[model samples]
Target: MISKTTIDQVYEAARVEEVIGDFVQLKKSGSNFKGLSPFTDERTPSFMVSPVKQIWKDFSSGKGGNVVAFLMEHEHFTYPEAIRYLAKKYNIEIDEIEQTSEEKEQANEKESMYLVSEYAQKYFEKTLWDTEPGKAIGLTYFKERGFTDETIKKFGLGYSLDEWEAFTQTALNEGYQLEFLEKTGLTIVKEQTAGDTKRFDRFKGRVMFPIHSMSGRVLGFGGRILTNDKKAAKYLNSPENDIYHKSKVLYGIYYAKQAIAKEDNCFLVEGYTDVIQMVQRGVENVVASSGTALTPEQIRLINRLTKNITVLFDGDAAGLRASLRGIDLILEQGMNVKVCTFPEGEDPDSFSKSNTYEDLVLYLEENAKDFIQFKTSLLVKEAANDPIKRADTIRDIVNSISKIPDRIQKEVYIQECAKIMQISEEVLYNTLAQINKKEVNEASKKIRQEQKVFEVVKNDPLVEKVDVQYELERKIIEMLLLYGNQKQKFEDLVLKENEEGELVLEPEIVEAKVYEKVYLDLQEDEIELSNEQFKSIYYKLIESLNEKEDFSVNTFLSGLNQEMVSEVSSILMEEEQYVLHDWERREIYPKEKQLGVAQLVGETILTLRCNLIKNRIRKLQEKTQDQHDDNSEILEEIMNYLQLNKLLNAKLNRVLS
Candidate 1:
């Protein structure tokens, strides 16, 4: 468990924008920051970070919470893991007590696998530097590849020993379970006919490359075999497990994320060494697909950092034509992609190793070509003297352009393609239209088929009715959260006999804290929030506001559970989402909620009272109609309730029918 003092230090020192900015590129919008939603595939910026409140909300996914909750949601970190990550990021020393055996065993399965993988990485690193065979084989291979000691250690490069059971036996001896070892694919286990189990190292005699998530947690490993065993594959990766999915994991993302955001571009390559060599040569913003085909999940990981991707390719790569298709995926995500190839005999690794840093940087800048230009040039060469092939190539280029979401960008690309191919713009536009129409038709067909499987209900009356009480209660909570600490003048309504002998209501103006006025009004009327979550949060919020002299939303949020934290953040940030659009620029001014806090509060209370009285009147009328007895008293009570409801509605400027 982390000490309370250390947790407090982390919360105080850590800035929400700074921490989230490492993963999601945030831009300044008013007092808050806005970015693409990491939780959803959104082109518009719906994810908001309020530095003032120290909270973030993703309107697309309806997920909102404090800094700790964001980590837990985005990175899938446990509560303790998130706190520790913050502590490490902010350079706060953690004071932690060792867990007991029972507590250690209580960790979930995924966490256990993570711990085992983490231990295996350390073990391999220790073997690389501390043992003889590791230095002789693995260390020599890396050094020969032109990697420095600092570079190797920075990426956590290591090597597994040649013996079959070297890693397996060591992990078992250290009290790590064999089950987790097998699960993480570190140890391969076999059961014998004699009822005994034989376990061997999975990456035996291979150099290790640890693959990490965006937050630098070791999810799995990529190992390269050194021996010339024709039967064995040259490279192997950890099998699919709960913690690691190869399609979603990118090599060197943990190291390259900051640079990618800073440089505003990502250099994509084909292998682990390509990323390392480029980063080592001062080109730090690079990631690898690990020689696999590109996936939307992988592209989205880069999308979070930047919208520009420059793919680096070897000049003599055998699968160049096949890999060109992957560039279409990038374009589909509405990202700008460019392709750069090295000399005939070199790849990014060899080229970076051979050239000086300045030369490498200059060569990339000069040689990089836009996707349309590169594709047209390459395919035009192949389609030389063949009209049909050239026509197909033109269609292919147009197809790629059709995937872009922005209409203006698509049109610009179409014009460019027309110029490069010596074709008319009308032809390319027609081709794009056909492709788009086909896609829309296919999508409609899919939706129709899905509709056939289930009954479609239209305009359900129950779905259309507004929950008036719920909205008013939500408004009350929102007001309390935003203006509870501020002092405001309010009109207290007093019902008494006016100048006449009849009863009438009078208003007496008074000054008090917003929270105090709200609390007293609710207590006097005996109104309790109908929603359980709102009720629980309402009392806690009042208690917190009353106890603290200096109120902080971030500090107040720290004391609530996850559910309460989400509710409070949503209530507080509801108005902020609209404020980001800068609507006043269009000469349309929306009323600011802060300008009339007192009026808003009083009106909301009056509305609540009116709603409650109307409900009472409704029930009394229903009882009088159902019962044959007790007619006079029920009728009188209903008349009195109607009068009170009318008075409250009048104060709210609401017409009662």
Candidate 2:
């Protein structure tokens, strides 16, 4: 467990803009910074970070939170993991509170697996340098492959000792449980005759590559055996476990994520060496599928960084066939896919190593083809002198184009495809329309089935009634957040009798801070917010004011949980965006709601009280209509509520019919 003091230090030292800037390219927009949202695919920037509030908001996805929350959301880190990451980044020393034996035993399964994987990573790296066989074999193999000492350390390359029980014994001596070791595929266990287990290392005699999550935590390892054992597989990977899913993990993502976003493009390769080699050669925005078939989940992972993927393949027949299989999946994700084929005998790893950086880059620029052009040209050659084959090839190209979500992009591709295939645009349009209509009908059927199931549950009598005052209560909370500490005088209407004995109104100004006025008004009216979230925040705000003479939003935010912080950030950031838009420059002035902050606060409380009283009057009338009840008290309460409601309505300028 991380100590609370260490967590506080991390939060205090880490700046929101600096922490989030490592992943997204932020540009200055007035007081806040705006950038393309990493959470969604878009050209226009909607992600905003406010240094003043120590929080960020993505208007596109409606996700707003503080620095810690951003790490947890963006990188899939746990709360403690995110804290530790920030501490490491800011160079803060962590003082951990050790867990008890029973507490360790009762730890979450997924986290235990993660802990085991991390320990194994450190163990492998240590063995690679300290052990005799590791240094002679593992270190030599990496150097022979042309990896520099810096690159080896950057990727956390390591080696496991050739002995059977070296790693397993060391892990056991360190008090790691056998169950987690077996689950993480770090130690293989076999039952013995004496009811004890025999354990062996899984990556024995192999050089190790630690695959990391986006936050740079070790998820699993890919091991390559050095000895020429014909019977054994050349490469081995960890089995599917709670912490690591092979289909969702991308090799070198931890190192390449920033470069990918910065370049606004990603280079997709086929192996770990390819990614490492390309990155080492100055093309930093590159990742690989770890030699697995490209999955939709993997494509979506790259989609988070950028929408453009350029597949690098050796110009071999089998390699080109394999690379073309993934283009449709990329198109389905609404991403643009381009293909760059190297010389017939080379891959990213070999080619990057053999050629100069400028030569390799120039070659890629000249040869890169859009997916439609690549697909059309490759297919047309095979379909030569056969009309039936030519027609089928055209349909296949149209199918890929129809999978694109953007209508503008689809139209553009269709025009290009028609020109290449020597077909009329009208024919291609009709084919695309038929495909779209079929897809729409299938989607509509699925949606209707889901709605039928949802409607049954939604119509249940157990559903609670909607509270009408929820919006008014939220308005009060919003006002306190925006103008809580400011001092303002509010005009209270005073009713007096004139010479004619008719009631007349005069304005009396009473001065107080917004927080004090809001608290006193709510207390006098005996009103509480009906919404639970707003009510909880109201009390927290009051407690904050009581604790400090001058309240700062950043200080108050430090005490809130993740959910509350996100809520407060969303409220605060929405108003900031409005101001940054600067509508006044275009001769369109937006009304300043905060200019009458006192009036807004007073009106919010008054409206809530009036609504609550009207509800009470309604209940009283229902009781007065009951046949079995004594109705005199209910009738009197209803009459008094009616008079109070009428007065409130008059004050609000509502005509009573």
Model 1 alpha-carbon miss at residue 315, Å = 1.2
Candidate 2: where is the Cα deviation over 4 Å?
1-9, 21-52, 57-64, 96-103, 192-195, 447-465, 493-507, 530-533, 570-592, 622-633
Whole-model lDDT per candidate: 0.90, 0.84
TM-score of each: 0.96, 0.89
In terms of lDDT, which candidate is strongest?
1
- What lDDT tens digits, residue by residue, belong to model 2 across residues 1-657? 777678778777999998887767677787789877778766567789999878899988999889988997887777887888899999999876765556657878877787778889999988888888878999999888888989998999999999999999998777778899999999899999999988899999999999998778888999999989998789999998888899988998889988988888899998999988888888899999998999987887787667899988876757665566799989988889999888788889999898888987888889999999999988899899899999989998999998888899999999999899999999999998898899999999999999998998899898778766876777787888778888898876555777997555566899988888889888877877776777888999988876787787777776788888888888878876775566778898877787778878767766787789988988777777765767887888788777667766777788878
TM-score of 2: 0.89
lDDT, residue 582, candidate 2? 63
* Model 2 worst lDDT run, 10 consecutive residues: 96-105
Return the lDDT, model 1, position 471: 87
Q: Cα lDDT for residue 342, model 2?
A: 83
